[model samples]
Target: MAALRQMQTEFNNVANRLVAQWRLEDGDAWAVIVAAAVAMLLWLTPHA
Candidate 1:
């Protein structure tokens, strides 16, 4: 339980720092996120 708590605290700190560092507006962020997801899907799809 103690190790789990420490892991959660570390994860939260990293997430908070990432949120603070990112500059994209909500719309731009969503667009980029969706585009990346689509690209990832395409890359993973098997081509015949």
Candidate 2:
């Protein structure tokens, strides 16, 4: 009961901080680079 509530609050606080940090960073170029890397890896790797 009380433990569950405490866990939920802590989770919310951690999630909010992560969201704030993510929002503060430059995400556009990072997203494009990540996508390109993933595509390259997929293209180069043998089918499994």
Candidate 3:
């Protein structure tokens, strides 16, 4: 669909810009994100 194509194009543009600016390895970025998410989850969990 036209809408989906437009959304994809916009996403690609933003991602490209970020990739250019950040200059970080994609794998390293994802690892850091996952680690932060897990730490937040642990902090929020109620203990018995």
Candidate 4:
């Protein structure tokens, strides 16, 4: 449980950073959508 919690926290941090950086670089809503899509794909991909 603790490990899962840690992973979730780290994922959130990375997603937030990506969103912020992309938003700054693009200055548009598409940056946010792209960031979210990337994050979702990363999370959904199988890890084996």
Candidate 5:
């Protein structure tokens, strides 16, 4: 029982870390792409 609990804790920790990292990476990439697109649009559109 104790071993199973320990294994479960470890698994949960690993899963949390993976999820956090994946989210950070995905968010960063999306932000970069969106920023680049907005920059391009601003550059292309003329403002008086």
Candidate 6:
């Protein structure tokens, strides 16, 4: 539990830093995240 909490905290800190550095608006950050997730899913999907 403690390890998970620490990792979550670290992730939050890094995300905050990235958002500030990139000067991204809230919607832009979410859009970037969703786009990355979709790209990753497409990349991992097996070709038929």
* C-alpha RMSD values across all candidates: 9.0, 11.6, 9.7, 4.4, 18.5, 6.8
- Which portions of model 3 show Cα errors greater than 4 Å? 24-48
lDDT of 3 at 6: 78
lDDT, model 6: 0.64
Clashing pairs in 2: none
What are the per-residue Cα lDDT tens digits for candidate 2 across 1-48?
676567557756665565566775647545654675577557646732
> Model-by-model lDDT, in order?
0.58, 0.59, 0.60, 0.68, 0.61, 0.64
Model 6 TM-score? 0.52
Better of 5 and 6 by lDDT: 6
- For residues 1-48, what per-residue lDDT tens digits would candidate 6 score against the true structure? 676567557766766666776674778876775676576557646631
Which candidate gets the maximum TM-score versus the true structure? 6
- Candidate with more favorable, higher lDDT: 1 or 4: 4
Structure candidate 5, residue pairs in collision: none
lDDT tens per residue, model 4, 1-48: 677667767877876777677775655645665777687668756651
Native-to-model Cα distance after best TM-score fit, residue 12 in candidate 1, in Å: 0.1
| Clash count list over all predictions | 0, 0, 0, 0, 0, 0
Name the TM-score of candidate 5.
0.48
Ranked candidates (lDDT, high to low): 4, 6, 5, 3, 2, 1
lDDT of 5 by residue, 1-48 (tens): 676567557756665665566785887655655675577557645731
Model 2 RMSD vs true structure = 11.6
Q: lDDT value for candidate 2? A: 0.59
Model 2 misses residue 47 by how many Å? 40
Q: Please, what is the TM-score per model?
A: 0.49, 0.49, 0.49, 0.51, 0.48, 0.52
Q: Which prediction has more favorable TM-score, 2 or 3?
A: 3
